[model samples]
Target: LMDVARLNGPPEAWHLGFMLGPRINAGGRIGRADLGVRLLLESDVSEAARIAAELDRLNSERRIIEQHAEAQAEAEALASLGLEDKGAVIVTASEGWHPGVVGLVASRLKEKFARPAFAIALEPGGIGTGSGRSIPGVDLGKAVRHAVEQGLLIKGGGHAMAAGVTLRKERLAEFRAYLESALAADVAEARHVNEILIDGAISARAATPELVATLNRAGPFGSGNPEPIVALPSHQLVDADEVGQAHLKLRFKSGDGATVNAIAFRSVGQKLGNALVQHRGQVLHVAGTLTVDRYQGVERVQLRVLDVAVPDHGPAMIR
Candidate 1:
């Protein structure tokens, strides 16, 4: 029921996952997971919705907290091992960092670097809990699982992509050492943030009603399954305008002369929007997902712009 409902709802699986599971996790991360679980398992829809909203708010707050911790982790990582350490990741903790949220940080690190990441948060009781994250090629969850099997960790279990554990405060150094040795040969990737692998390029002509239906066949893409992104050649700008507080609206004409609608959400002050605005008559590379925007009761196909690059021919000079 949840799966079918999610398929019909908002597209981000992670956010949806949070909707079902992590709302309860918010309590656990901050106060008590048991409370979060109880609110959902025991409450009616209205009560549950209130709890979920609180949890969502908490997650947003968690982001602010993690931002500081991430900076500290990156600094510590750079200071101790330098910026080039590709084989290992760091999971340090301070008095203020919460154990429940450490794993999220670890997951962020893993996603940011495309390498194994460990994040531990120091608890007031002199204990620490941690989370680890990994990508496809590197078996990060398994690496941590190996330590759990060897009894190095107090308790641990999770999926292949992410895992969690508990440990005594003093075991921090040993844990890092154990993880380092466990991943001795698996550190083969470079120190670069991995970009989303583009499925293939497409022509504006391919953006059609029938094609959109075909693409929907590959639906329910989230987490494991990703939405397809199609790249097109530079298009002529019909008009460009800003919307909301931080969105850019673009009217583009395909090579075949069909006009297309594009939106750069949350891109008002970014390089991509600037390039699009400045190069009104020029060309720019655009990457984004196919979305249907319902406006005034009509549905229109719009590109949810993700990335833009300066054309090889460079920006056009306009006075």
Candidate 2:
């Protein structure tokens, strides 16, 4: 493997380590990621798609659970003694919150405030467990490693932006103090508001089938590897309608006069969706995930609406 990687790059090859391989993790925490492993090892596209859909459905369910935990975490953070002042936050509950969802909640909090965050839902007894998430330029996993080295934490591991740990449940207070001490004055005073990072202006003509294919090389995107966000000057909002209770589906006529359908999921009171619906014929900057959508036998690219802010304004990110 080193030789193969070296051929592609250099002779001083370094083997990347994955603490918890994703497929193994999916099985340990969730039910079955073996399906994905099998799909990958074999050239089974249809079966792979079917299995992947189940995984996506599982993730969707996980998202719902995460949202609930996040609401509680926000309140907990606010109530903590001078927690907001610390620049980093750790929210803990003695075994009531779902262990699986703590990491998700941490991620939400991090996104909501643009701070390093950790969420713990460990048993109050002997062995406790937790997961964490972090912001850009901060490595929660390394923080956990340092804490463990100092005997402040027990068993913990993760990549740059996320981590999981196990320790004495009684040590929650100790852990909190340690993290505060470790992170204090480590970060600058840059206020982080979640904003979509756009990849400059792209015309509908640039969004060709071939371009979409080429752009997809920068994918298998998740966590750190994110899909690029493309912004248009303004597409004519030919028709807009509400769908799925709160969602807004809009059909846009691009500069090439081509029709592109975009859907803003869960955007009722949401700023972008509401703005588009409230003011028809208004040009707004839309930030969204671009994807190829296939219905029946037809294939087309569509934007998975992310945020909409007034044009000439900064990008919009859902906090």
Candidate 3:
């Protein structure tokens, strides 16, 4: 899997870290414990190819599972927020969810709502295995251990950013309540101080292939280090359409008359998609990371949109 023939340039760290990384992780995530390492070790060309293909299939299945769980978790999170004005953490559990993918789902929910989230998978015997992802400054691990000490969780431990828990299904509600009370102050502080950092403001014309290449040097972005978010200020939405099931493809134009392309993945049915589709010909500030998109031997800079706001609305903040 060292081939970069189809890639625009030599593979950057992200290609190996994200694209291939998930395939390797699928083994652990999906219960095929040895599949990932086996793929890396198989020397026979045909055998390695087969393993790679199977891993790819598993990764795709993982995405589908994560997507479904995320949808359910997001819905629950939003509904819970409606009931409590200061909802700090979203704890969702259900029977039959693949326990392996719950952590991924929690990550997606945390990203969407800017809150600490936990997804629990319940087994037949009233036992649950849960994974959680937390926002900065919230000690998810400490809280989990505290829950164990308080007898709210059967067994649990983790760090500030992530955690794992095993508890009786009956204790789920108690654990949730414990976390809400334990993390209330920290979550509130995190939300109030959380701000999207913009690295720079550039015209659509300035978001070029060269710029994308330069940014890749600083990446392989994940957890603590993230890809930079830049603003395309005052760009008017020109063409907007949904592509690949739920990704919203967009074209924006600056006053100087240059056009740039963007896509908000899995956004077709969300607020961002609805706003963009309705914003034809309207000027807005868009923020996201830039990537070099290669298709059919063509390479171009495209923005993976994260957030957008009216020109007068100021920088996007999550609060």
Candidate 4:
């Protein structure tokens, strides 16, 4: 269904995977694997709609669960590993955390701590089902599989970006030690590598639906293939506010009076979100991906903010 939609949908619509993938994945997280499959296979329109609606509800529920689990897991991880000082990986486990949501929690940890991370859901009999997420240079799957071969894990496997594990509680310490020893070098290298590549710099007036469509022709973008990151240099921040739990929404204006809307998802309470909320009217160099958002049957370009930096004090020009 998504493949067909990507093939025929408008360039902007091709990115609908972001909108639909999470809803489908929610079924698995909430213990309803069959729901995602059913939605894809259903031939009846009414049945499909019903399944879609149910999935949407599950996705919402998953978000609430994820938020709670992530908070707890992050605190545990940081306390256990002094992540703020120097930590390469965070491996945290607790009884009663949902197995389906552990991967999502681990991903959040990876982003927050800037390192590979694991979130384990310990079950009865000291056995655990764990999921881990990693930064670009860390091979989490290989590390997990290696532990399995070394008899540290009962069973586990994954790719470079993410992985899963099954193990007894007795081996938890040994497993943690093993991962730190194996991945420390890679994690250190990844952390030190900071290369920011921008596709182009455009003014607020140039950000339009036409530009978004043109830039998206080379992409049905998601995951490994992301949309472009461009800079809006020296734009004045007009207004900033928190919305939808932890997202930062902003209004920006250019010197010539052009304005644009932007958002930074899951950034509330983080550095970027706090800075945006506090620094109204500041001129900053904003970096973000261009996306088109549609509402009330109207489409407009929106910048999905990635980062912000103080503008250079020299003459104003696109860097």
TM of each candidate vs. truth = 0.62, 0.64, 0.71, 0.76
Q: Candidate 2's residue-wise lDDT over 1-319, tens digit each?
A: 2112211111132121111123234442445647556645767778777766666566555556666767778877766736445546554555566677777677666655556777877664667777887765666788889878878778887877788888887777888887777665443432453456787667655655566787789888876787887876577666667653455666666667776666665566655666777656666666676666443455566666676666555444323
TM-score of 4: 0.76
Off by over 4 Å in 3: 1-84, 111-113, 136-142, 145-161, 296-298, 314-319
lDDT of 1 by residue, 123-238 (tens): 88877787888765556667677777776788887766678878778888888898777765555543333344456666666666567667879988764677888765676766
RMSD of each: 7.0, 10.2, 5.3, 5.6
Q: lDDT per prediction?
A: 0.65, 0.63, 0.82, 0.82
Question: Given candidate 2, what's the lDDT at residue 55?
Answer: 60
Candidate 2 stretches greater than 4 Å from native: 1-71, 81-86, 124-126, 181-197, 219-226, 236-256, 263-281, 312-319
* lDDT at 199, model 3: 95
lDDT of 1: 0.65
Worst 10 residues of 2 by lDDT: 2-11
Question: Who wins the TM-score comparison?
Answer: 4
Cα lDDT tens digits for candidate 4, 1-319: 2332221124345335445777898999889989999988999999999999999999999988888888889788879767346667899898878888998899888878778999998998899998999987778888999899999999999888899999999899999999999999999987787444689999999999999999999798754675788999889999787654567668789999999888777788777787777677889888888877664467778887887777764433221
Q: Is candidate 2 or candidate 4 better by lDDT?
A: 4
lDDT of 2 at 256: 78
* Per-residue lDDT of model 3, residues 1-319, tens digit only: 2122222233362255447867888878988979999988999999999999999999999888888877787777888888555588999988878999998888777867778999999999999998999997788989999899999888999888999999999988899999899999999998887766899999988989898889889988866687888998899999887654566778889999998888776677667787888787899888888877665577777787887887676666212
Task: For candidate 1, report its TM-score.
Answer: 0.62
